[model samples]
Target chain A: MVWNEKAECMSREEKEKLQIKLLKEAIEKAYNNVPFYKKRFDEAGVGPEDLQSLEDIEKFPFTTKADLRETYPFGMFAVPEDEIVEIHSTSGTTGKPTVSGYTKKDLDIWAEVTARAIDMAGGTKKDRIQNCYGYGLFTGGLGIHHGGYKLGATVIPISAGNTKRQIEIMKDFQSTILTCTPSYALYLAESIEKEGISIEELGLKSGIFGAEMWTEEMRDELENRLGITAVNIYGLTELMGPGVANECMVKKGLHIADDHFYPEIIDSKTKETLPEGEKGELVLTTLTREGMPVIRFRTKDITSLNYDKCDCGRTTVRMSRITGRTDDMLKVRGVIVFPSQIERAILKIEGLTPNYQIIVTRPEYLDEIEVQVEATPSLFSDEMKEMEAIERKIANKIHKEIGLRVNVSLVESESLPRSEGKAVRVIDKRNFD
Target chain B: MKIQQISVFIENKEGRLKKAIDVLSKAGINIRALSIADTSKFGILRLIVSDNKKAKEALESNKFVVKENDVLVVEIPDHPDGLNTILGYLDDDKINVEYIYAFVSNKTDEAIVVMKLENIEEGMKALKEHNAKILTLEDIKNL
Candidate 1:
């Protein structure tokens, strides 16, 4: 199932050599073409010539999301506007969306990397890919679409929503591969059941789900519900789309296409590179991007990198699944808690549905966290004392996980908002100002 | 005989009790006797209503967590030693009383005590052996 075995299974020495060469060229291109990189390089007093080896990238100034916002639309593009063949921008919910421009060559590299991702997920030319990542401005849809095409698979560009239609097409077309965000995939699975379609009737063999942070418990739920091998894909709109890295059939971790985009783990606070196997913010460098060659782009995603060769026979370094974003981590009552921790704790309890909402409110002078979880049919009881005990158990588990005693509220089933895309899990009502 | 008591979970907040009462009143459900067991976070408002089913439906429709359980309604003299005499009978039989709340009956010189016990049958047997007057659901409704 290894795609482009030569590229993926290259010897460590050979891959590092290629990475060093690409890194040098990308740095030179960024400094000479893009004014932003040139100014940054000048400020850091480190030029492209200083990058002698792959490790030398540490001297470069790290590019951040804020830096991308400052540039706005096309400040990061290294090539002329005429050569740019495609553009993708983030949702920009936080502020202005950071735009990523790609030349025709850049698009080809994107397709190649995504094709490798598809291959890693056990996809082949005969497989039908039902891509549900959303088309238009979002890179997820088109990214997987082009990658499926490159792999010579029959790509169904259904592009997100219309749950009934998605189920119908999936059954009729006998799609062998499914691609979308993990949350949306779960939602689609729920819809498929609601539509009275048996999971066995569908021809899905595997799925490539990513774009939002998810937990291992979520993976188990998706796999059990859909009867497919659920694998995690890692990518960002700021980098390339969904093709940056993907988990193979081995499913140990996502295998990064380090040949194209170099991966690094850095201490988010210190802005220093962390050694392999240490969890920190993931920073990426587009080693071969022609249109927008970025140097040391801080992704802000928290994860660790594993250089150990995967059992799938790929020598390319793999990254552990993202745990949380530094920006999204919540601080409650002076205790730092990630929404993923709450999710993990809730999922550990039997008979509770995965759907939940964490509300952090300042009632008076103290901060309180209230976790409203949906009560599944199995969890709901006729006895009030039994229900109260379940609530107390959930509170105790969450308290053990986050070191903060939170109020657990058992809400009606499906009462919480399900995401068509990313599930909004946390609502912080405390005004920091 | 066991009497039906409806317990509504009310959060410890302003006007929550009023809101629960409002729902019952709007539904034409009459409250017979009520007691609240509270903690710092929330309260369980235990009630003896004229119509258990109607009161439960009303509170539940308003999104309240309501539970129905059996409690023994025993008739005790309105004098100071009435409750102590009943407790002494139950204690001698080793029957545990989880909770007890009472209201004076206007029709007689006796007070009606609602007793939630660890074992309702055992507690009732002990009370009957001691010649205690246990009121049925019909008796509480008429009162």
Candidate 2:
């Protein structure tokens, strides 16, 4: 099922030799075309010739999401605007969205990597892919779309939402491969169940879920519910969308497409490279991207790399599931809690994409956390006994996640928003002023 | 016989009850009996209205978390011992009355009691043997 044996399964010695060559070419491309990278390279006292080995990547300045934003529209593109063929962007909830421009060559590379991902997920030409990721500007839909096209699989371009129709297409089209956010997959499963459609009624064999943090427990839930092998796909718009790394059938860890993008782990604060298996921020360099050659971009995602050979037979280094981001971790009553932990706790409860938001407020001398869970129509009850039991159940799950007692309130379902990458569900109302 | 009742969730805050009442009023749902079980955290407002479907649709359209459950509406004398008498029969049968709320009928001297019993089947048998007058949805609408 490996798409390209030479690239995916090459020997480590040969790989590193190839990496050194591609790294040098990418550095020279970035320095020559991008004034931002040139200034960064000059300020850091590092030049293209200095990148002699993979280890020399340490000398290069780390490009960040902030740095990418500073470049704005076309500042990061190594190719001229006429040559750039496509653009995909992050949701940019906090500030201006980071734009990723791709040349025809860059897109072909995206197709190959994603095709490798789909192949890794047990997809092939005979498979029909029901791509549920949004098709617009987000890389998710089009990424899977292009991969399916390259793999010669029939791609159903049904984008996100319209739950009823999603299930209808899932049944009528007899889709065998599914792709979307992990939360949305859960939501679709619950919706299908509500429609009284059995797993035997559909043809789903595997799924590619990503775009947010998810847990192994949630993975089990999705696999069991949809009766499909759920694989995790990892990428950001800063990188070339969702083909950077993906989990193979062995499900050990996500295999980073080592030949295309180089992966590194470093202390987020100190900027020092950590040894393999030591957890830190994930730093990536687009070694082969032509339109935009990112040099050591600090992704801010917390994970570790494993160079050990995978049972799936790909020599590419695999990274553990993203636990959290350094920038999004929250401190509640001095105890560090990631929104992913809360999401992990929330997933324990039934109904797709549990609608719960953590409300942090300091009423007295202490900070208190109250999680507001929406009482959806499927879970709501007319009796207080049943409704309160649901609340207490969510509260107990939250307590187990973070060893602290917090309030649980069942609010009207309308107040809570449906998260699809429904970013920022935590509300920090505590004021320091 | 059991009748359907609408239960609406109300947070412990000002003007929530008024908003819920306004929804039903604008829908022109004539409420037969109404009661509020209050806690410091929140309250549950239970009601027997002229139309259960209309009232629920109205409340839900206004963004209220409304639910429907079955409860018994019984007719008794408008005296203290009337409720005591009905309770003694259920107590003899060991059926627990989870909650009970009463409304005085304008058409008669009898008081209507809405009771939610944990052992509903047992409570129904006991009440029937004791000759308790259980109201139907139509009887509730008339009351």
lDDT of 1 by residue, A1-433 (tens): 6779899999999999999988889999999999999999999899988989888999999998899999999999998899999999999988989999999999999999999999998999999999998998899999998899999999999988898899999999999999988888988887898677889999999999998888899888889999999999989888888889999999998999999999999999998899989999999999899999888888889999998888889999999988899999998888889999999999899777678899999999899999998665456443456668888999999999999999998764454787767789999999878
lDDT of 1 by residue, B1-143 (tens): 99888877766678889999999999998888888876665666889998889998787666676778899999997778988998999999999877888887676778888889889999989999989999987787678
**Tens digit of lDDT per residue, candidate 2, span B1-143?**
88888888887778989999999999999988899886676778999999889999899877787888889999987777998999999999999988899988888789888999897888899999989999987777676
Q: What are the clashing pairs of model 1?
A: none
lDDT of 2 at A74: 85
Task: Write down the C-alpha DockQ for each prediction.
Answer: 0.10, 0.41
Largest TM-score belongs to which candidate?
2
Chain B structural similarity (TM-score) per candidate: 0.96, 0.96
- lDDT of model 2, residue A198: 100
Q: Please report, as a residue range, the 10-residue window in candidate 1 chain B with the lowest summed lDDT.
A: B36-45
